[model samples]
Target: MTKRNTKAKQLILNLLKAAKSALSQDILQAQLGDAVDRVTIYRVLNSFLEDGVVHKIVGDDGKQYFACCKNCSDKKYQHNHFHFRCISCGKIECLPNEVEVKLPKAYRTLNFNGVVSGYCSNC
Candidate 1:
């Protein structure tokens, strides 16, 4: 699902990479300041998701958040870290510290999600 390199796609990728946290499509579109149409945004996002360029997460409030993948080609990041959601501001971001989950011996680790919800610094 790789998209041909285009100005719109590059813009979107750069924005996501520089973003401190995940952003909803609405927010992302708004940030674009009408530089791109909604349809193009969706197309690009869908392609990026399929290509492992980004990962989508559903927050506690049921809102979808999208963040850029660090190295999703092999998907090693799929189970590496946790996410933090700000209940007050409704912003979601990846937590810097790794979450520790103790498992029984011989238990194989697979895909998992760890979430920590609270107020962010600004909220």
Candidate 2:
């Protein structure tokens, strides 16, 4: 299904595209401030996830963060790189390098969420 480009969707897309690191719903809410409602934001995010416009990252604190997808599609969604979480700033970033994981025979790999925690270069 072709998703209509709404104002809310454009706003969220711009925010995600300009973000250096993954952003949480709270951050988006604070940034948007009264421009968009919480429920609308949630729906927009869910649609973006389904459309492969963004990818979700679950932090160590159990908060969901979002970032623009570099290589994803509606048919096949996959994140082959690792997410780096800064220990000092608690910021999550999607690493550009792709990771290859080897599994035992007869085992099938599904979703991958490999996170590496450490102090970023700026920290």
Candidate 3:
């Protein structure tokens, strides 16, 4: 399925695609220049998140960052990937490989929460 393109959405999408890694709102705004506003950015982020066109990488600094989907044509992000955070520089990098999360056979009946965070080589 394909989505109808809008100017603001395209701008936000391009910003994510060009980012080195996950980008904070300030960085995105700076990168986007005067083309959009914070509210618009927030809305676009939320919409993209719902549509799976982007993914959020929460940083230890208590800020949410965003990354682009490499396969953007699919309108969905592969959920099995991991994101690496640099402790010293506070940069977030997406792991090239997928990380599998499987519950134990005995615990499969229970609901669980999972999140993985750690320092990367850049730290």
Give RMSD to native, each candidate. 3.2, 1.8, 4.2
Q: How many clashes in each candidate? A: 0, 0, 0
Against the true structure, candidate 2 has what lDDT?
Answer: 0.87
Q: Residue 111: error of model 3 in Å?
A: 12
* lDDT (Cα, tens digit) per residue for candidate 1, span 11-103: 999999989889888888999978989999988888887778888877777776789987467844554578899888777898776666778
Off by over 4 Å in 3: 1-4, 72-78, 104-123
Ranking of all predicted structures according to TM-score, beginning with the best and ending with the worst: 2, 1, 3
Worst 10-residue lDDT window, candidate 1: 71-80
Best by TM-score: 2
TM-score of 3: 0.72
Question: In model 1, which residue pairs have backbone atoms overlapping below 3 Å?
Answer: none
- The TM-scores, one per candidate, come to 0.76, 0.88, 0.72
Candidate 2 to truth, TM: 0.88
Residue 2 shift from truth in candidate 1, angstroms: 6.9
lDDT of 2 by residue, 24-64 (tens): 99899999999999999989998888778888888887888
Clashing pairs in 2: none
lDDT of model 1 at position 98: 60
